[model samples]
Target: METGIRDIVLKWTAVVVAATWIIGCGGSATKPSPPPPAFPKAPAKKPSVTSPKKATQRPYKVGRNWYQPIPHAHGFTQKGIASWYGKKFHGRKTSNGEIYNMYAVTAAHKTLPMDTWVRVKNLDNNRSIDVRINDRGPFVRGRIIDLSYSAAKRIDMVGAGTARVEIFALGAAASGEPSSKRPPAFVPVDYNKGNFTFQVGAFKERKNAERLRQALDRRYKNAHISEYDSPDGLFFRVRVGRITDLAQAEAYEQILIEDGFNQAFIVAE
Candidate 1:
């Protein structure tokens, strides 16, 4: 009886150990589904880029005064005292980037656009000169334009330093009109023996002066060569279009400048 009891206990013990072993092997084979396949991390995002802004055209102030550059200077005119500059500023870069030549027929204005053509009339003596606006200046109160040395000399204002002047804007066409509208044709007037004339060129050689006179004669009603005896030496001067009226001479002076005779200046006979 004892032996049978012992055999029954051993059989039950063997069955419990086999069942535990089977459960352990099944848990090891499953492996927790390989940690759910480890989903790939999302990619990092990048930044965006942009462009720069443009400059604005706005009115600005300078010193104790305010200045607004006229959007369009066409037909703009002003009258005030005119002064001049010379050797001190020569060969320096102008406000418009041009090398300032005090001898050139150019001027500076507080507000006129660069390259503007202006006829400046000296109210004191009724003398006039044509100048191209290429710089900005005369910041002093009551001053309007700053004339180049040669331009001021033409109007007989060099000795006076400053003079009351009338500035007329030219080549500024009326809005909607062609910029190239033909200027009025020059009228031929009776040559006054004592009238003032424009000297387009002066040459030591008479033949050279004659060649310029011939060129001017074709375009002008009257062109002549005159002998000038100066302290420097004798020179042949080519003069064109005699006029007694200073205003008329100014008009002709502008025409001569536009025709590329930039050195042309008024000479009183």
Candidate 2:
């Protein structure tokens, strides 16, 4: 009798356990899984900003020829054939790596340092305009400068195709010392006094100057290489015969020219 009662108790206990499990599972299903484990949303993206590339004022090559830019534009003046380039070079990368804009008041020079501002005066009409040097070109013989379309138009040279213009470098574009009301009077370069030397060659490579210096030291007295730290890079200027007066330097320069160093020039030391 006891065993039968125990069997009935066991069945009742099983039914109760099954009902509790089913009810517990049903409650869990209705509870919604803790919102699927929420994650923090990413921050909104910001617009990207791009900066202009810095210009390099180093020596560059065109065709088989190489040209070195001048270190400074102080007391710089030149009279040359000025030509303008428009659609052909518009939106192109210039020598200094700047985008070319035909309408901008900019110009190109074969040897002038980049960012130099110069006043271009047309010799024919006496019209003048100021332009900043940002490129390098007009590589043709006898052409001194290349102007932008608008710069050439302002100087009354667009119709002429080429104009004889005198360019006087005012200063660097960043220099705000010059008066905008009146053009600054140009002071001619002094070539009389001060110690001077004959610069026979300038090379971007130090070894090239070293080889020349070694050859010069054997033949020419006081031949040495002077280093110049330009904005673009270091330059090795091969010079000879340091003199106190400009006249002696000029005399030595002629001698260097006669010795097959035709591009030799006198530079004040």
Candidate 3:
């Protein structure tokens, strides 16, 4: 009976030892440790922001027509009908590739170099305002400048659809120069030297251009034909006179206009 008791005790002790070994080894015995508490992921970084780029001024196209802007605003002055545009072109892209702002003190000129600062005086009321040229326009035959709504209002020309005005170029606002509020003294364009010509006409046919040029050469002396390869095709332009000074060119242009060359306009060669 005592030997049977000893064997039963030994079997119990063996069972206890096996269970202790399994627990110490960290086997599937201890509720499988809660999969190492998950760590929260770090927040993602945001992209950096940068400022918009400034636009550049260059030759541009409008309504299937190409316009070559002058190089500078040296001594530019003119007297003609001035008009204003507002909501219709407020957000459109200007000739200089800038967004149009109707309320800004800006203006459009057919050929004045972009970024030129011009002072406009309303002859009717003597009201004046300084505006920067940022686009091209006033496309109308007698219109010489197109002002922004705010610019027109400053000159008291908003009530009138158009106003007779005198414009004087102040050139690009440079350091040590007078500010727009106080424009520098008006300097008349009296260039003693420059290659200036008058573009009288452009023709698709070289023969027609040559004939006109030959006729002009008899009286104008320096009349010639220039060929241009436009996007539409090739064109021959008839130009007359090679003069020095814009003043002389302007006077000559008037004479040509009276002589039936109504389409003549001054151009820097």
All candidates' TM-scores?
0.42, 0.58, 0.63
Give residue 101's error in model 2 in angstroms: 0.4
The digit string of per-residue lDDT tens for model 3 on 1-269 reads 11121111121111111101011123365585655322222225312212212323333445544455654567778999998887667667776666676767889897887667888999999989989877778766678899987899899887666899999987664545432223454444444457876566677899988887776665556678888776677888776666677666666656544554444556677
- CA RMSD of each candidate after superposition: 44.0, 34.1, 36.2
After superposition on all CA atoms, how large is the RMSD of candidate 2?
A: 34.1
Per-residue accuracy of model 2 over 1-269 as CA lDDT, tens digit each? 01121111121111111101011112357556654322223225411212224445455556544455654576668897888887666667776666776766888898777667789999999999988777887877668888988788898787667999899988653434332122354334443567655556667899998987887676656778988776557878887666676555555545544544435555555
The whole-model C-alpha lDDT of candidate 3 against the native structure comes to: 0.64
**The candidate that achieves the highest lDDT relative to the unseen native structure:** 3
Q: Could you tell which candidate, 2 or 3, scores higher by TM-score?
A: 3
> What TM-score does candidate 3 reach?
0.63
The C-alpha local distance difference test score for the whole of candidate 1 amounts to: 0.59
- Candidate 2: where are CA atoms >4 Å away? 1-57, 175-212, 219-222, 225-262, 265-269
Per-residue lDDT tens digits for candidate 1, residues 81-199, read: 88888766766767665667676688887666555567899999998887777777777766888998878989998777789999987643233432222223322332323365655
Clashes of 2: 0
Candidate 2 minimal-lDDT segment of 10 residues: 14-23
Backbone Cα, N, C clashes tallied per candidate: 0, 0, 0
lDDT of 3 at 156: 84
